[model samples]
Target: MIGLILAIILFNFIAFKTNRRHTQNSILHIWLFTIAFQLIFDTMIEFKYHGYWYFDKEVDWLGLLAHTLLIPPVNMIFLNWYPLQGRLRSRILYTLIWVAAIMGYELLTLLPEPWGYFHYGWWNLWYAAILDPFLFYILIKFYRWIRSLEERI
Candidate 1:
């Protein structure tokens, strides 16, 4: 609880300090994709499939927020530094770094139950570790496609 809020505050502060939203349209597009992905995956894993669920000490809203609030800035950071036209090796390295970070964070949520927001039923860290790279690659490709369209206009 304390840790999660502090992390969010710290992340938002960095995002604010960096002024990463150079274009409102671009931010909106990224946020749309991020929120959509979070909601869909969260709903499936947490609610529908019962693979995992979130919990907070205070309220249910706080639980859902684990996905919504934390994910966009992460996606933004990933999209922002992504090598758009790099060589295959560079792209692979970049993807690996982001995926590793995502997996690391997800694993952190398993910190001794009460302080953590996530509880797994069938889902495991390995699933997250594997899926993160594919998810990031899709998002990066979507970002590039959007940028190309913007250039056309």
Candidate 2:
């Protein structure tokens, strides 16, 4: 868990530094959203398993923070590589593609033994299955709103 947190932080730092010129705020927002989701998910997992949860766990806190920071870079990379631009149709397509990619990553946690980062169980799996699509939709809408605001500015 510590290692994962460190890795995520390192990756986020690298991504942020590399992309500082083009879309820092957008990427930051993505990172914030990702982190927020992770926190909520983490809380749910802890409540289900441990019966209680606290951020006093240094490693868990670090992991959550790192995961949040890492999200922007990961999503930014996806968007840049795929180049989502132009019409509403294209935007929807791009958003779906991102949703698919996020789901793919989440599914990877299920392969073999449950990856320690994400608890692998029926409830967690179901939660993720439901959560990902909703989150993706919200994210897409948020992105659209941000874009519109940028245009107006």
Candidate 3:
């Protein structure tokens, strides 16, 4: 719980410091929408089907809180640093880097119960490593689409 709160605070602080452009509000909104969908999907998969579990069976709310707290700022930071003008190679590399980071984080969460925030039931690391890059790709594409749509308006 302490770790979760600290992470939220750190994420928010970084976002606050770096995400200053008024123009980015739209990007932030898009990120929020994407992360919200992720949370809902995760809830169904992790809770309903028991794909994974958090902490113990007792304080499951922290799992929800963790997802809600972490994702938006992560998306924001990813976009903030992403090279909007860069070539396909640079862009793909950037995406891969973030994907690696996410996979590493997931691996950390897979540690033993008291230290680790999460434990896999049916889920495993390889699935996360493979899917995370695709997920980030979807988010980047979605954000770009939203930008283009707003431009047309």
Off by over 4 Å in 3: 20-24, 57-59, 112-115
- lDDT, candidate 2, at 91: 60
Cα RMSD for candidate 1?
2.6
- TM-scores of all models? 0.86, 0.57, 0.83
Candidate 2 local lDDT, 1-153, one digit each (tens): 543455466666766565633365566666677667666766666555543222333346544554565565665554444444568687667766766766676554434432334444335445555666576666656766666676687
Sorting all predicted structures by TM-score, with the top scorer first, yields 1, 3, 2
Candidate 2 Cα errors over 4 Å, as ranges:
1-22, 45-59, 79-100, 110-116, 124-127
lDDT of 3 by residue, 31-97 (tens): 5776787867776777677777677544366777776777777777887788888999999899888
lDDT (CA) for every model shown?
A: 0.74, 0.56, 0.74
Span of 10 residues, lowest total lDDT, candidate 1: 14-23
Model 1 score (lDDT): 0.74
Ranking by lDDT: 3, 1, 2
Clashing pairs in 3: none
